[model samples]
Target: MTTVTAPPPPAARTATPAPLVSVRGLQVAYGDGPLVLDGVDLDLFPGETVALLGSSGSGKSTLMKSLTGFAPITGGSAQVAGHDVGTLRRGRLRNLRADVGQVFQQFNLVGRLSVLTNVLTGALHGAGPVNAVGGFSSADRQRAMALLDRVGIAHKAKDQARTLSGGQQQRVAIARALMQRPRLILADEPVASLDPTMSHQVLDLLQEIARADGIPVLVSLHVLHLALDHSDRVVGLRHGEVLVSSPTAELDAERLAVVYDVSDADQEADDAGH
Candidate 1:
């Protein structure tokens, strides 16, 4: 008779709560237009940087906008910072926005305002009678300064925002976002205007913030190399649909080719048809 061996037991699974941001079957359309985002799903966990990648018009920015209630979400569900984005009330919308930090490509700072002042504005969201001109609490100022320092722009606190270089401006914008004490961050093309060096610096800083603060960062990027180099995971979009979503370690440049393929094939078909 042949001998038989029993198999070992399977490992136990750990129980973790929901992610900082959860999205499912997300669909969006503007003014009766075609769906800009269709059947999308995403998750952003604590201490992770998730890069959003796509060609132009692929719905990359639209996805980011949906998280903050900027885009018109027609269907599906989205939750960010513990708020149900699709169902937020008029009053609750402000609260939701306050909890979400945002960074943008243009560094959306008041060019005439002092860097510190610009950073302080982040606290105004949902703030009730905080005296924007001359009445910020001492603790708020200290925190803003600390955030500026964290972004490596503390020494320029007194300088006008317009005087700063592109990298410095972006850094200041990041510091401003930090001032919000946000649970989740949505960075839409945060490094699009920066040079190669500045882009790397900004992305590295964002990644470090994500890990250190235990916050989830969802940053949109056009450059494939930057996404691969900086993110813990990547979500690729093609013509408003998700083409690839996976951990960075499990992916490479070739694997992300799907983001460009849909548009490329359409162009090819047009040529062939002609």
Candidate 2:
């Protein structure tokens, strides 16, 4: 009898990648316009919520779009969930979209649809055309309800999406995203429409999901306080450049103001000269 060993347990799969989303020297420009994003580098690792902060037009939205292949990448590379944004073909784009869960500022729910139906739409990305017209399967409905429960809104499942309050609606949006079973999540100013209290609530929820699911959550926020309160790391952009990238505990409002205040100062100087 040959001495058989179990191949040393396959080496414990030790060389796992550091991040689920890796972006290097990412550049994005619209048609013939100047670069909206220039050499931006960001990495979103599992179990972390990275808050992207900047004043308006610092390319925060553009950076998020680049990861999903919505913006034109004039140069550099973006790899999200192991797919190369710059190089993926059409079929791959569908797969990429299916893997990434996106939450928009508007919540993006269909108002007239039942909250559960809206959440069920997320599963469409992973479904075929034949399955769509037939409506959601029992398994999909169950999963959507589970997602709603996870987001603390299972009771609202039968309500029309528009009937919910802003915070509740946002919770529905989050549930919709979770229904995709995404490998990564990108939220663009997810709480900009909510009040201070609701904003805190939503951000806390996002952070909780990131840690619990061990998925990277990249959220853009206009408020410095919110970012500091909820994120594990903060990345600040200024004039389309990365001005600050550091762990949240190591940064504060004063330093972060560099990204927000300078634009105001420049406008003031121009007005004074005029």
Q: How far is candidate 1 from the true structure (C-alpha RMSD, Å)?
A: 5.6
* TM-score of structure candidate 2: 0.89
CA lDDT for candidate 1:
0.88
Off by over 4 Å in 1: 1-14, 132-134, 261-274
lDDT of 1 at 256: 80
The local lDDT score (0 to 100) that residue 242 gets in candidate 2 is 97
| Local accuracy of candidate 2 as per-residue lDDT tens digits, 54-138 | 8789899999988988898889999999999999888998899999999999999999999999999998888878657757789
Candidate 1 on 187-227: residue-level lDDT in tens? 99998898888889999999999999999999998677788
- Give me candidate 1's TM-score against the actual structure: 0.89
Error at 153, model 2, angstroms: 1.0
In each prediction, how many residue pairs overlap at the backbone (N, C-alpha, C within less than 3 A)? Answer: 0, 0
C-alpha lDDT score of every prediction, in listed order: 0.88, 0.89
